[model samples]
Target: LPATLFSATVQTPWAGIVAQSPLVLVLTGAMWITYAAIYFLATSVFKRTPQDAAVLSLTVALPNYAALGLPILGSVLGEGASTSLSVAVSIACGSVLMTPFCLLILEREKARAAGENSGSTLAMLPVLMWRSVKKPIVWGPLLGVVLSAIGIKMPDLLLASIKPLGLAATAAALLNT
Candidate 1:
């Protein structure tokens, strides 16, 4: 499956999609995660009667921040703001890809137990897009890139503020890890 996508990307040769805006990549990831989470919540978390599912979900999901993410960022982005942003974006994307699938399996087990067929989407779609649009962090990177690309550098102070907050979040994650 991954190979196929890689091949398609190669064939396309127009996928200038090299992490244009950290926000777009981040949002796409988050959108994926929430979609997965809601799927699990509706199908597994809500339906399942097992406490172990929570533990299983935790065990199967969250990655080691200080370990895997740091090395990847260091290797790819080096030790700088760009590295920090890249690592943060990559970690965010990777989690969205993996966590939801695990939760889906968990949810499917739950839906089965609850005697339900596949989950329903009657009340899910609109709200999901709304949530996606409302998220600023997800759009921030994209917006920043767009604004920058158009010869607009936000005030230095604002950029400075964003950087510190980003670093703080990363440090906090490392501590939690």
Candidate 2:
């Protein structure tokens, strides 16, 4: 949908999101809780086979940041909208932010599939969380968020310089990809 229409629909709540800290944290927490439940249930409850479970888990677990997320937020939040920028930071928190967690799960599943003991069995989750927390994708967006929250306005000259560069870069990346 177009940004204008999306703005007309979501502007009130989106504005409130940007306006407060506790609300933001609550929303973020709710999102993660939802994701965890979906991922766990996708793997545990619904799958008839291991591969089915893996695929299910991955599908629910993966964030299609570059696809559904970025464009949708960009459209909804409109040009130069801070909330859009905020969502941009999150959407760009792509698999890089998540690969380690994926890897850790895959490791345990592989061990179980191979009928080998993972020794302590409990180390898996902490390791996965640690890896995810330490990842660059997780932290990079946080830095962007901090800058944005501080109202760091880009200068006209800087923005002008970056705009075409962004367009060209996107076109090039799309073509190459």
Candidate 3:
């Protein structure tokens, strides 16, 4: 997933997309609000466990934009549209902001289920954060962003080799979805 994210990031004109502040804000805001709504509803109204609520919310909120949105939009809009940027921004926001929250909840749940003496949420925060940071899904786009910001490019050979795996990841994700 990180490889896919890195590839998408390096390929997309993120700077140009980000320059359109309204698009960025709207996309980011919409995703976050959707996630929050589902999560709170699941936990409060539906009486789901935090772990279940987190998973349910993220699943419902984050779409498979790369597999579905990019191909369809590119085909219909004829390649030069802002669609790729929109998809990339959506993917980045979902991976960076939403995934970690789900991971943190899942990690806490895992520790609890295993009968580990995990402390209070505040005490567990550092460990949870470190675990989240180490995930490829979390760090992949982050590394991509940093490299792009510094004007460093992935060599074509590396991209070619990783392309297959990235595509496989996309297909698997689509199938799962």
Ranking by TM-score: 3, 2, 1
Tell me the tens digit of each residue's lDDT in model 3 across 1-177. Answer: 788887777665557546756866786688779989999999999999999999998888877775677667788886764776777777777777788888988887787788764678778888887888899988987777667667778899988988897778878877886
Candidates in order have lDDT scores of 0.44, 0.47, 0.78
Residues 1-177, model 1: lDDT tens digits: 122112112221111235535554565555556554654774475675333544344444444432355556676767665554544444334333443444444454455577754455333434433444344433443344344345454555654555555555556655666
Worst 10 residues of 1 by lDDT: 4-13
97-120 per-residue lDDT for model 2 (tens digits): 344445556656666777764565
| Higher-scoring candidate on TM-score, 1 or 3 | 3
**Candidates' RMSD to native:** 10.8, 8.1, 2.1
Give the winner by lDDT.
3
Model 1 / residue 128 / CA error / Å? 2.7
Q: Which residue ranges in model 2 land beyond 4 Å of their true spot?
A: 1-24, 48-58, 61-63, 92-100, 113-116, 124-177
TM-score of 3: 0.87
- For each of the candidates, give the backbone clash count: 1, 0, 0
Q: In lDDT terms, how accurate is model 2?
A: 0.47
State the displacement of the C-alpha of residue 96, model 3, in Å, after optimal TM-score superposition: 1.0
- Model 1 pairs in collision: 44-107
